[model samples]
Target: MSDRAPQPVERQLPTEEARDLLALVRELAQREIAPTAAGEEDAGHFPREVFALLSRSGLLGLVYDEEYGGGDQPYEVYLQVLEELASARLTVGLGVSVHTLACHALAAFGTKEQRAEYLPAMLGGGLLGAYCLSEPSSGSDAASLRTRAVRDGDDWVITGTKAWITHGGIADFYTVLARTGGEGARGITAFLVPGDAPGLSAAAPEHKMGMKGSPTAQVHFDGVRVPDTRRLGEEGQGFAVALSALDSGRLGIAACATGVAQAALDEALSYTAGRQQFGRPIADFQGLRFMIADMATQIEAGRALYLAAARLRDAGKPFSKEAAMAKLFCTDSAMRVTTDAVQLLGGYGYTADFPVERFMREAKVLQIVEGTNQIQRMVVARHLAGPESR
Candidate 1:
């Protein structure tokens, strides 16, 4: 063997291969997701069929391990696919992302036995997972969650409620964080509680301003039983696992934000190019042209930030701060971009006739979920100021 280090294959894909995948994803989004998205939102219907289609296409496991029947693709590629999906239907895109977050604990920290027992159904399209982190009393201050998991011989008896659980009523499983130690962050631990466990129930779906098709509810766990084997990692590891999952999950939200922005820009561009005003195309006006330019520029910047953060994570680098930054920046940018996109559409944008208003509604949740933008700021500040700063 030569003394020199072996050459590493390029992590980045060839341009042609990337383009082909993008084209395929875009086609799927347009052909499958776009057609029913408006009606689904209007009727408050979940597009269960769209998720089945995605599962059939292997998009659900895009960033998972190949051994588990995942696509084993890079996060960079996966995020781009998410962008396309959200551009068509944000509800589906976000639901997919949330499902992945709920599944993250088993994938990252599960024992080999646990992995073998659970990974297949989760990786396959047969099961969907929901992350349970937030509570009615504990939104940003997750460490103070009041949910309790008491050891009861071979099984743990969990009692308390998990609020704002995405897919709470519909998911096959829930990854719950509850107190197992004393109080505060150190006291928390994670458990893989099946959705059908006895004493587990979900409240009626929340009526939200946007992403109406996606369900959100409070999950009550009254003496829900989980085997000791279902405990994820060691006791008191819940906080770490939740934070780790959030770092990755934030990137997913950022990607969704980028997609929302891109969709708005594409719509604005198409409408302005042909929809005439002053007896000519309004796109020709310098003011309107400048607005479009700003939209495109901001979208590109946000995309770059999130992609860079994803790359860091895939490479096993410390990515928490970067992920928070990307999440905060991209979601904020999305709120601005989608609002501007509606403005570009003039009266039509404000009405249900165009998709811009819908996009705006969908964009708002991205900032609030995963971790609120305020929480994201706190996370970033902690990283910058060190442990001593108040």
Candidate 2:
């Protein structure tokens, strides 16, 4: 197989600048990312230096205000860039999305002082970040998180554990959500915790099904003292901050899912067109051809779903329902498409010699991350039928 999969689907972009930006991202993905993805993934090595290069290229800060070193791009353009990166390597694409989610709370709700102090460095300083919202006991119901943050003289002493943290051990900083008042979501608060805080540590990285190149771990905060000034938004408002981040983050996952699906479809087509069966290319077989057609259709539908949601966000309107729908449909489509790709390649797709197995593994997490497909359905249903009756 070639170093790269097929080129991306043609995108409808609004500006000359947005089109140019996509070109740049695709070029970088093909050259700097796709070539090394398989080997690095097998080694389970996080490519920190690639992130540095992305920072230098100003790719890391897309969709944020430019005043603090962000790219000032709209979500529509930014998400397409993510799709391209993910097609090359999901570890990079999803990593950038999580980092952006980590930045959302501070950028949206931080005091002017906090933005001036942190945004520039966080956005472009080559510093990676992790979001800490899930805990060992809390998964679907994040409002039930048990981590506690108690007030000190002028500081807050945090104590608890966060689970499934992306970039956990290697992050430069963490955006942590912990209980600060009475029980429940409203009592929680968001804090910007430095990775080197004296009591902060991470458990050994989880051995995962895929995206081994990206680290996931349980991060422990034991009396990690953070000044009140580092708190994001108001006290009792951290859950709100987290929900906001997840709404946007769900869209990011949708785009990444579409990318993975697209890559799988591309590989399957390439393989079938070359492999011969009964003295003819397997592409001539109606069964395989139908499967390829279905995969391509789903990928296109998934891409359109995400881009529509992204445009809603760019227009400054409500997009939560669309985001959830995108996340659900796209991730489900990715699972189906990747599984089919593996089937098309027969035994080779199941082996490490091909990347489809890895793609299938990575696709599983998109269904689970940000929110499960079940949670996505809940979110979308709430929009249509109103909140569940107590």
Among all candidates shown, the one with the greatest lDDT? 2
- The alpha-carbon lDDT assigned to residue 217 of candidate 2 equals 99
Q: In candidate 2, what residue range of length 10 has the lowest lDDT sum?
A: 1-10
RMSD of 2: 1.3
Q: Give candidate 2's error at residue 107 in angstroms.
A: 0.4
TM-score for all predictions? 0.94, 0.98
* Clash counts for all predictions: 0, 0
Task: Record all residue pairs in model 1 with backbone atoms less than 3 Å apart, i.e. clashing.
Answer: none
Task: Please give me the total number of clashing residue pairs in predicted model 1.
Answer: 0
Q: Write the per-residue lDDT of candidate 2 for residues 172-240, one digit (tens) a residue.
A: 999999999998888999999998999999999999989999999999998999999999999999999
Per-residue lDDT of 202 in model 1: 97
The lowest-lDDT stretch of 10 consecutive residues in candidate 1 is 1-10
